[model samples]
Every structure is written in C-alpha cells, then in structure tokens.
Target chain A: MSDIQTDLQAPLQTPAQPSEDSGLILPRRSFLRGAGTLTLSAAAVAMLAGCESAAAGTSASAADISILNTALGAELEAIAAYQVGAESGLLQKPVLDLAVQFQGHHKEHADVLAKTVRSLGGKPVDAKKAYDFPVDKLKSQNDVLGFAAGLEKGAVSAYLGAVPLFKNRDLAKAAASILGDEAMHWAVLRNALGQNPVPVAFVS
Target chain B: MSMRPIAADAIGGGPRKGAVHRAGAALRRLYALPLAAAVMVLVIPAEAAAAPDPARGQQIYDRCLACHAVENNRVGPRHCGLAGRQAGGLPGFDYSDAMRAAGFTWNRQTLDRFLADPLGVVPGTTMTYDGIKDDQERRDLVAYLLSLKPCAPR
Candidate 1:
C-alpha cells in the first residue's frame, strides 16, 4: 500500500511560521506530514464476536488504526480551516453558504473516521485547540478562498497518497471516497475564485 | 473516552527531513506521469473507447455514495429517476434555490454538462461538489445514473 506513500509525504512549500501556542511551524506541512511517515504493513483486522482482544487491545492492527487516526487528524484540520474562513466574516453570502456546506462535509468525514477508529478499538485523535492557519494572510475573501483551496488540494493529495497504503481494503475504499470529495472541494473553491475548476484532467 | 494530542512538533519538524527526501522522488514520479499517460493513450485498445461502461461508472459512483444513493438521498437528492427527471424534481428533497430553479431535465447532454461543472451550470447550488472532470468518467457516470430505474417512494 505504499504506492502513493512518497506522494503523500511530499510537503507543500508554504512559508513556515511557528504557532505562538504550539510552537509548531508550517501550517500546510503539519497535517500532510502524518500520512508520509506511516511505515506500517497492511494487516487485515480479525474480529471476534465478544472476546477480550489479544495483542494491541483489539483485533485490528495498530498500523491500521494509526492510518485512520492520521486521516482523522487531517479531517479535523480541514474543519478548523473552514471554521477560520467562515468566522472571518470575509466571505459574502453565497461563498459563506458554500464554506459552511463544505465544513459540514469535513465534519461528516471526521465523525465517520472517528467512529471507524473506535470500531477498530483505537482511540481517535482530537482536534487541536487552534491550528497554525495563516490568519494574517487571510485578509480578503479571495485570500480565504485560496487558503482553503490549498488545504483542500493538500487533502486530496494526502488522501490520494493514503488510499493505497491502507491494509484494509475497505479503509482504502473509504479513503478514496473521501478523496473524491476533497477533490471536488478543491475544484469548487478554485471555481469560486474564478479559476479553472478542472485544471488537470487527472488529479495528482 | 480520553483523547491524545496530535504530535504537532513531530509532524512539523523531525520526520520532515525524510519526508522532504521522499517528496523529491515523488515529484519526479509525478513529472513522469504525463509521459506515461501519453504512452497509455497510444496503446489503449479501440474497444476501450466503446460506449461508456456502466460497470466502470458504477465503480466511479462509489465516490458519490457518500452523499447520494440510488434509492434514497443523504446529503443530495435520491439519484433514482435521475435520468430524464426534472432537475431538483424529487419530492420533499430540500434543494438549493439555484437547483430548484435550474428548470432543466436530466438527460445525456444535460447530465454531461452538469456533471462536468455543477456550479458552472447552476451557481449557488448547494451541492458544493466539483463536477467530474474527466469526460469519459462523466459519460460513464451518466450511463450508470441513467441505468438506475426509479425506486419506490419512501
């Protein structure tokens, strides 16, 4: 499942600046970094009806759970990103509706990923109190749209990179499904900004 | 249930060296894709270009299953009866004003354009999805949608 492992690990070249509270630098690189470091093998989950789990507290491999959590983390970041844009009051009416709707989608993604992690006997990752979004850079609606669009594109790439690495085919399939959604988000945001919605025939 | 903090520092700093290295290799691979696709296009069998395959469209439809279903709606309208049905015509399905007023019927041509660019076709529609970009994918997806027979009312 390392087919897109390298691709997923490719960090976007954004101006790196540390968040005041977390002291972590590179907002764009933060979420995208998780999928790149996964070295886990894809071992299938073996579930038993109602028994105490064996190794790792459950039938699912730690690696699979880790992958889901990593994806979950990215989804959380997306929700936060949209929240920043939505609350900025920069977007007008129609764009605001679109952001809210897209944020809802991310929330759905986060909820499903969290439930899946729990189903696998793994603790889901929590969203950070604040993410290292470039608030200073988001001065206008266009800027906010561009910022959100970048995150969506990164999400698409991250999921694209992750889909092949999942040990569970179902998880991979789920990730691909979300990947499509992210791609659509990217295209829509780009369209909103008056850019080519479908710039490339094939998504990278 | 208890939750753990994301290792922000670990993600932003430490492993990035290796990630940056891998990214270089990945970029090279990405750059080569066009050439590979070109070769693939040249070698694609003629039959491969035959009428859109509903089977393949069905696979592509997996992406849409998150928001839609053949029999019922989730985030979007129920897809059954999509073919030749009025745009936003489903009863009781709350559609965006843009969609409700789209005033068009779903057919091969209309579906193709809409699938290619939903917002472009109906700006302010709350679908919030980027239409399918690939021409063949849109056609196949339209084929799959058309193949679906209208399901019974819920």
Candidate 2:
C-alpha cells in the first residue's frame, strides 16, 4: 500500500530554491515542486489499492503477500513523512539531512522487500507519488513532533509484526536492523519535542 | 473371444507358473525404486555440522578486531581468551548494566546467538555490531577467537 504510493511518487523533480528563511534542504519537496503537480499514476494507484485489498485478507495468499505489501508501504510512508518534515522549514539542516539519509535507507529496504516478493512469485506494489497527510492540521511544533513520534511508533509496530512472518533469514535481519533505526528516530524526535530521550527504560 | 484349449491350459497349468514369476519380478522392481530413493535421502548432508576453516575465520575477524584486541582493551574489550570466559567478567572494564546483568558465560553457542542479534539476545547490552550471518564464517570467527590465548606476564 505505502510502496504503491511511493512508487507513484518516484522520480520526484527538484523545485526552485526556497527563501533563506526556509532553512531546509528539502530535497524530496524540491524535487516534487520541480515536477509542478502531484500525480498519482493510475497503475501505481491500482497497485496500492490491490495492496490494501491484500492487507484486508481478501485472498487466500493474503497473509504473506499483504505483509510484504505493508512493509513496503510503511517504508514509503516513512520516506514521505521525512520529506514533509524536510520541506516544511521546521527542522535544521542536520536534521533534514538525517531525514534524507533515513529515507534512502527506507528506499533500500523497500527495494529489498520488492525483490523478495517477486522472487516468491508475487507482484510488488508501487509507491504513490504524493501521500495525503494532515499537514494543515499540524499547527504547532508539538504537532510536528507528535506526528514524527507516531510515524516511528507505527514503523516499529509494523516491523515487529512483519518479523515473525518473514520466512527468509535475511529479510528478518533487515527488519531487525531497520527497527533499530526507527527507534533511534523516535528518540531524536521525542527529544526534539521536549520529551524524555529514553522512554520506559527502552533504548528508544 | 471365447477361451480356447491353449488358454485353458495356460490358466490350468504351465503358463500360470510363468505369470507368477513375472508378477514377482514386477514387485521386486517396485520395491527397489523406493529403496534407492530412501538411500539417496539419507545420504544428503545436514547443513549445520559442516566444519569451518580457521583461515577463513581469521579473515572475517579482521572487522571485529578493529574495536577489539587479542591482548588488551581497545575501543571495546580485549577479546583474548574469550571463549569459556564469563561475559562482563573483564576486570576494570566498564560494562553496561544490562551486559553485566546478563551474567552469561561466553561460549560458542551463546556467542553465536549474541552476534546474530545482540540487542535481541541481551536487551540492554551496548555492543552494536550487526553480526556475521554466514554460519561457517561465524564458526570460523569463534574458532579464531578461541585460539587466541592470553599473553604470559613479563
């Protein structure tokens, strides 16, 4: 589902440089801006819908197929969320760069999952071009922080849920690896939002 | 067609003996095929017990040796004589509370599990290496680590 959304949003174009006050690199946003309009390609959207259907237990093979699709979707969502933060002029350059780097990692993970799915005789979902977020609803710094925290929490849950379902050892390891990064992100975001750096005696 | 005298003779006498012999031969062939299949299945090797080459293990250990040392402490602990040593027992080294509390004695099996997923095995331990996935390589690394004896006092 998220993979389909991201795939539809691929080849993001670079936009004109924002004013100095923007204080962000916003690579993904700039690229999207350059593209001028957000278009969710028909095929990509169809694939995303199919992924959602599979996730909803519509078919006999839904369990495995849906898990892969959901993993891809979550990675895409993470990338999109990071892009939004970068483009919003709310974060510093270092934080923006970190988000970009993390997005790249998520992309790599999505690609791995896609390949695994194809290898297992399943179709990979496409990522959407533009994810619909409640950007307007995020009225304050706390709002942004909460959004990021939620994203990380969702990512952790998604990865944890998918871990047991993965039959391949490499995939399992990859999930575990990314789960750590997600925890790191959660910590950073929480600290930025003025929360405890380590919550509940967990590393995150 | 109606049975003739020859058919009657075959059913009643000589030909019956030949039919019985043919049936026995067919039965023997059927049993032999599955017997050969079973033998093939048994002969295939089990994956886990294959011996690791120490030389290859040494090469893989190079990545680990950067943070660890054979003789003494570096960025991490001295890995010398690590096998069979109690984890967190290195005197004077500051270990994470989680690592100390784990109270594990480092052996091949425990080390393998720890290396495979450090945080998973010991929740609060601080060792961050992503772990060696290849079974042979891990075995070899363990062998190499075990081979390093503590240096004698000057």
Which candidate leads the pack in TM-score? Answer: 1
For model 2, the superposed segments whose C-alpha errors exceed 4 Å read: A1-62, A140-142, A202-204, B1-154
DockQ of each two-chain model: 0.01, 0.01
User: Comparing to the true complex, what docking class would candidate 1 get?
Assistant: incorrect
For residues A79-196, write the lDDT of model 1, one tens digit per residue.
8778878887677666787788788777777777777777678788787665555565666677788877766775674565445544566666666667776777776676566565
Alpha carbon lDDT of each predicted model: 0.57, 0.50
Q: Write the per-residue lDDT of candidate 2 for residues A37-113, one digit (tens) a residue.
A: 32223343334333433333333243355445546655665567667766665544444565566566566656665
**Candidate 2 structure quality by residue, lDDT tens digits, B1-154:** 0000000000000112334444344334324544775698799864555676667766655444223435544324666667677666666555545455554567766666665555445443434333555667778877777777764443
Per residue, candidate 1 scores C-alpha lDDT tens digits across B56-150 of: 88867655533344664433466766777776677666565545556556777667766665545554444434457777887898899889887
Worst 10 residues of 2 chain B by lDDT: B1-10
| Fraction of real interface contacts that model 2 preserves | 0.00
List candidate 1 stretches off by more than 4 Å.
Answer: A1-60, B1-154
Chain A TM-scores for all candidates read 0.71, 0.61
